[model samples]
Target: EQVKVSKQNFLLGRGERLTDDIVIKGGGGPKEPPYTFGEARRRLSPMVSETSSRIDELPQAACPGDEAVISLTINPEYVAKSFFPHELMRDVGIEVIGSRPKKTVPEKRSRGREPSEVFTTELFARGRRAAIRNWSQQLPDWRSDRGSANALISIEEISAPVPHAKIKGSLPEQGRMALETVLHASELEFSMIQAFAAYLESQGIEADLGHSFFAKGLCFLELDAPVERADDIALFTGVRTLRQMPSLRILRPTVRSADIPTTDLELPTEGPVSEDVRVAIFDGGVPENHALTQWTSRLELPGMLPATEGFLSHGVGVTSAALFGHIDTKVPLPRPYANIDHYRVLDEAPGQDPHKLYEILGRIEGVLSSQEYDFINLSLGPCLPIEDDDVHAWTAVLDDRLSRVSTLAMIAVGNGGEGDSILGLDRVQVPSDCVNALAIGACDTPGKDWQRAPYSSKGPGRSPGLVKPDLVDFGGEFSRPFVVVAPDATPSLTTTGGTSFAAPSVLRLGTGIRAHFGSNLNHLAIRTLLVHTCEEGDQDHKENHKEIGWGRVARSLDDIILCDDDTVRVVYQGEISPAKYIRAAIPVPADPMSGMVTIKATICYKTQTDPHHPGNYTQAGLEVTFRPNDSKYSRNNQVHPNSASFFGSSLPGATEDELRRDAWKWENCLHAVQRKRGSSLINPCFDIHYNARLEGRNFAPPESLSYAMVVSIHAKGVADLYDQVVRQYATQIEPLRPVLEMPIRT
Candidate 1:
């Protein structure tokens, strides 16, 4: 009884950092060219002439002085390092916009010839287009030293505008159609789009401008056009893609609620505990009569005029879950940790308005730009599954917005898990693929035998974000439905289920952590802590990685903040400089002991995204190397200690070669655990290298990155391991404490 009480009293690190970054020096050698001069020319010449001829036919209405956009696909061998076609593109009067990774098949199945990146560049005015047409003579010599084959050899193909890559999603058979034009992010290009709209109007094709926004370096124009012109609009020059806009619907689980049972429960009337922490919920509007208005400030969006009863119930259920998790049938309910700002962004008539997707996104963006928040929850997004080649407007804009702020945002991965697997409709939805935020899925229950809910989305997300639903939490099941406050005036409760409620449930856990400790932990630290302490299934099933990534998050604050009998966990929250190496020592006992020891580390960082580059989306990545003992050195090296497999080796996919080359660098979050004999542990630490890129290539003069890492050590035979680690590291580290005391729920 005494030992249990002592362990619960001490919390983990509250941002009282204990270490500084130590720099390291490393070197590498050069590589020989893969493609010869003749082989490269054979592939690139036809593409240039085809693009030049297409540019001549393009209407000068959208481009500035008839300048157009073209794309070049690079071989995979080049994208793994710093080999680009900079000189070749510049000499041809072209300026690059950005690049995205795409699948390719070379003529010969060479060893390193795999799927690679595509660069989007601009061809200058009329004269430059003519210059490119006289290709054999006008283009530089690939054999000459001045016009080296090193860069141009990287090109696999050049893309033209009318390639049938546009026309996305399933289009409605009749009525006004909403088609979005994905144009280049250029001022002159937008003017061309305006003139093109007028030209369409003159041709008797209606093009109602809905909305537009800049994502990274691309422009998205939403227009309500006539259905008859869909085929003609797809062939427009310089327009990258044309697609049907997706609609937003209330997220409901697979199990119908008509047969689900409900029960009444009691609740507390006390207000939120924290004054510093601010949170927001973007969903359908709540009803005027509800029990949570005291801790929640409900506000309608600018154009919200009416509401639906079903939609209102969904909004109330999600908001209620954010305040109080599943109501215990046997235990009393707990009070909210902080107040909420719930913005009603959608209503019943969304189906009638083809432009509702853009309108709702605008309202959400408007609020984010105006107000600063510590936490935000989004239980809704476009009802469309994510794709491999291109990113949707909703995902691009929302990710760009979240990267600029210091807020922890949580989004629900759509309820498409029951869809047809052959068509990939079961994959995670758009905006949930935002690498900057947590895409949450739902578990069927909160007990030890929990499994992924049949309605929760599944994923092998795009490359940089392979592990899709970052974490899972208990939603409702047919037998044990989740409980929420009823829409009536009293504090009565009802049962329901969906990933929508699962999302806010995770947010509630995060807010509770902040409410208990105040400003001691930042958003990045909290994110890392959640990943570190998540409980995975006892069995090792590789396929489960897609179903519930990093397993389910800790259920209660006591489970996260309290110490175990033989284990100790600490957090490091700080910033790392670009293109540099910093080392963090894993805190262990001063002297070695008997029995086996276990070590686990988790690192999470916020990254700037390149929405156009889905495969290479995250701009920043950390390569972590674990060195167990300072005394152990490799036979071939004399300077630094040897590195053992720690982070990348445990992940399901990837060959040994790909893991070391660049695959590990693109992962924004990593977690792994290893157990070793205690005698083998002398002094352990991790070497972290920060790598930054732009458009799938090296980015010079990069900015610093915010990151958080948690490392825990557990000794098999040491019952007092936590106390020993705290005392031995007294010179550098200490336990975290709460800034204020409240009647916290156990």
Candidate 2:
């Protein structure tokens, strides 16, 4: 057979870090303000008094000396650590243990205000109850005495953790629950929590830390106690949120669907797949001796894991999807993209086990801590939906683990879109909110006519990670079910429909991309490329971002890597020091061109997280500024050039929320396109500045961050643009070619 040539996009490191400054300089900025001391005291005194009074009438009584959690809402502007009310808290003898960013809609909207514009992240402090009553009685005078320290004037409100912070709905008087305690990991705090647990044990209530994990500086643990007891536990200064653990609430564990017609499918011919690529599926246990054995192996824990029929079946289907994709009944089954190791993380009583969330995560974490994989797909997570004011243990631990290694994880956004949206039950589930991983949602079908599957979760995920279900792929629908290998010993197929299958299907594609492009394209670059070449079709103009996100993944590998005649795509993979700026120039033809040109770019990076700060979850952010012409200067600022809209601009006629500091600026996956006349372009480039924060406040020193960018330029009537770019930047950039045979599927 004649070998066909392939045109490949290239990588570049043309931008270099700064070595020396032409001139020495120092800089400072004017500070943003909050409320004045007197007004703030006047507004907060009543709240404190009411809370002080209310605390006495609670299910649990708080002795003046007993530790209690009091929430102090602060002015939005004073969120930085420097602006924290530390001095005042010390004066009042109350220690501020922890804080999370919050956004509240002003009761009254101004004439031009949208919710996003009207709300910026405000700080809600967890204060250890100390002299709060005395402080309330003389609130106005104490802050005044400190004069400059009255920065506590930022206090907007004081209350017992608000009603919304607690577990919602009713639960049996004695039921199993999970308690999230606000502890910042100190010997003193740990002792307090241990003592509380001991007290609970004395009462015969179970408060085990065996399966516990920390989130947002809070410890979440399994507890078996009465509803009244749960309420009393909330009184402790360390506890923040509580939830009723569901019984047998397994998600996607049952592969429910219409039975498929008998079909013949062949397993991939056993041979060495690209040794460079590694993939894994963290799900229920797959059936023993399944036909997928050629390319799939189970990572069994120390002992034999117990499994139910449903779990095994669901596991087989999920692993099958990762290996074979939505099996095509029309043609012969294709070879597996890359050999995958399936970890039987979930066993027989996962859903029935209240502490299963932690156990499952522990298993997954243990595997990640040892073996490394290039790609991983998780089709299951907690049945609970994500919350704005909180971070779940599963999400925090997984995100932290992923950040330390070079791995691309895909999470099913969940199959709860049909749930009640008004109550947010229909939103993306926990762990998928992870800023470091791709949260996959299912579209109804595999064709261009597809829409988000009715059961696939939706999302306007929490800000800073607003875009959710990173990309959609065909999971399956009742009308058109997804076919996968069954749990039967012999090669067989079954029908299913859910986001569980959608996630691995996409992972299969990623591994295939890695197999084709070789190691030159790391996981981050592959992520950037997948998101960059997304096909939105009519969705490009839809207001369904909350549902479809960046739109569906291109089904075929060719669509993603192959470029059009007038288009040229380049990938930038590098690291930048914290608080420094780097330029990523948009590749274009050498000569001045005519007609209109469109530039589409997607930038992706992983961040070390602060689970304690849901409002400021990601510790790193990139402030990308697009400057189209080097010679043009803004009239207001002479030193820097003029800038134009790129990633952060709102769509036409869109009433986008004005988030405090613009949440989009910190989003990990940023995709946007702009069309302009070719003549206006003159060395256009994006200036990216990395911003670092810790515990919702600036840090003294920051670490370097890794980032990948996929930018493509398409010029009308410029048939030779790709050739021109390749020739002009010959020394700087080269094509990313296949290191092995490219798989062919028709």
Candidate 3:
């Protein structure tokens, strides 16, 4: 058979071998291996020299000291190159501040042409004038290295900052506009707030600085101005100034309360509180006199004011749901098993000042770092929707804290899913987009009829596309909302619906899992178990995925961990090192009548991150593969016989680069496959391979990265499959049994 290979394939480092039984109908012919491989290699050898000469001959320009930021378009071949591209920047005194995948538009199909792929990264360098000038002169050499070694495609100066539409749109007609701006930490010495204020004054625009945030090398500044002068202020502080400062990143509108429908509700008084699980709820202050008050230990954190009547309902309802499963009086339930600690972070008023809300980041950090709690439930978030290109300060802070702690936090995905706004679909609000936190969305009801609530947030998440609403829970439908305690002192019940209620329901489930597994179980293991047991309904449909995530979580911990006859579940909890592989073998039944075998697995891990680099946020990623131990299922015969690697390449004809570009680098990943029983395997054993990689800078490849893997095998019409496997490989396989803890009898 004749094989045709393109020059681009040679450039991408994929043309080294020609596999069996394939006909490539183009340039190369079979029986000419030396000629085919030799010709391509010869053509690729002179690329560097040619590129270097061309770069040196091109025009040169001196870069200003203030405008030291440059964006590099890396060649797609950079990953396969011998040298890391970032090292080139370092040699020239350039600092690779942050990087994100460059967005590409698919080209229209044309005859005899393949789509092109380009990788772009941004670099920032700061030094004295002489150093800046010297580095600028080395541009040609940098370009030469990039072109020859396939490290970079092009280098260009980043001259301006982009204006945020939300900031401009939120400006008032006459009064001053309130703006929240995040400046790069490197530029803080410039005193950006003062510079901007002075600039505004020169334009006869009065400006007030309200708050400043300093964390993770970020400087958040709050500015207020009259509505009429807002546009002028925006113009003066726009892209041109960003070019000069190189550190100011984004300017957004401060969030304010929007009218949401609310009705008062009475607290549930039927359940007794057990001290088995400890959870902290951060929101408005909880009233000490509520019906569930005896079950909770209330503490108002310093800097938080007392809760008022208007702000009491939200906190009361969320706390009630977290402590007691559901607020409906008709649903009979046992005494609550989880203890509660309520921390008031929000003010008692109906609405919060945006500046004050921004200040809450520090308070949250303090509580998360110092407080002792097994689980944290956050029913609050900003009104602003998360941006694909930017990681909000709130989300970054929360993710950083969660990664460092053993405890897991659950955040509401927000109730902004209603209306015609694009944010209503596939745009989970900030903090909820925190990749480390389990962001919960609202389901319309409980049990089999559960659907995504109209007011529940949806998400493909921000860039890198971490699927949001990791799990959904009953938050109540429009017509059948969850009942809650009213704001008034009297005992009364009101119906309401939002993701705020849904988060606690999931937290309640986490508490149960914690109770069974004990506090020793890592958060990743618990997260894996919860996602492993999620019930998928209409999830195969692509649209429903963004709306419901992995689908609604199981109601009980036993339902999640325990397996019935004919099904075997295995759980692996361990850590993986960079560039190393962890393998697990599963013993399969050898019976011809083993029936259909279905395999489902969930992998969850926590990763360190460069919060400033929204484009390349997560620092570590897990690549997983599941396949039969049989050697016959080689790469040539099967599309993805090697299992679903980090890029999910098990599907037919998917290329490595294609999968790598689409893989989710977030902390949580899930994949499942089902196959009918057949006699193709010589060995009835299956293997799982886990590989870990350190994807960004400043991340010390941990000696071992902790992770959890849950695998379940089910057979149809084969009642003895579980017994057969357990008996055959008793030492290698073990059933996942819930640790039963007896309830205290009252």
lDDT of each: 0.75, 0.72, 0.56
Model 1: lDDT to the true structure: 0.75
Better of 1 and 2 by TM-score: 1
Among these predictions, the greatest lDDT belongs to 1
After superposition, candidate 1 runs with Cα above 4 Å error:
1-4, 14-20, 62-64, 109-128, 140-142, 170-175, 186-189, 198-204, 258-264, 652-661, 742-746
Instruction: For candidate 1, report its TM-score.
Output: 0.93
What is residue 527's positional error in candidate 3, in angstroms? 1.2
Backbone N/Cα/C clashes per model: 1, 7, 20
Best-performing candidate as measured by TM-score: 1
Worst 10 residues of 2 by lDDT: 16-25
Give TM-scores for every candidate, taking all chains together and pairing residue i with residue i. 0.93, 0.89, 0.76
**What's the C-alpha lDDT at position 701 in model 1?**
45
* Model 2 stretches astray by more than 4 angstroms: 1-35, 46-67, 77-95, 101-138, 142-150, 162-165, 173-189, 199-210, 247-263, 540-542, 651-660, 743-746
lDDT (10s digit) by residue, model 2, range 1-746: 88766555433333222111222123557653354556666777788888766655533323223555677766554554456665666676666555555555432222433423233344444343446667767765654667544666666557777434565445667655554443443333456556656556655555555556654466666665566566565554455566676332365532366556665556667553476688888877777777777777877876546877887888888888887789888777777768878888777565455666667778888899898889999888788788777777788889989988999999999988888999998999988999999999999878767788888899878776888878999888877889988888877777988899999998988988898777778899989888888777465655577887788998878777777768888878888787777776677776777899898888999988877667778888887888888788858657657789798874221225434356666688899888988888888888888778776667644468899888888987798787888788777766666777665543
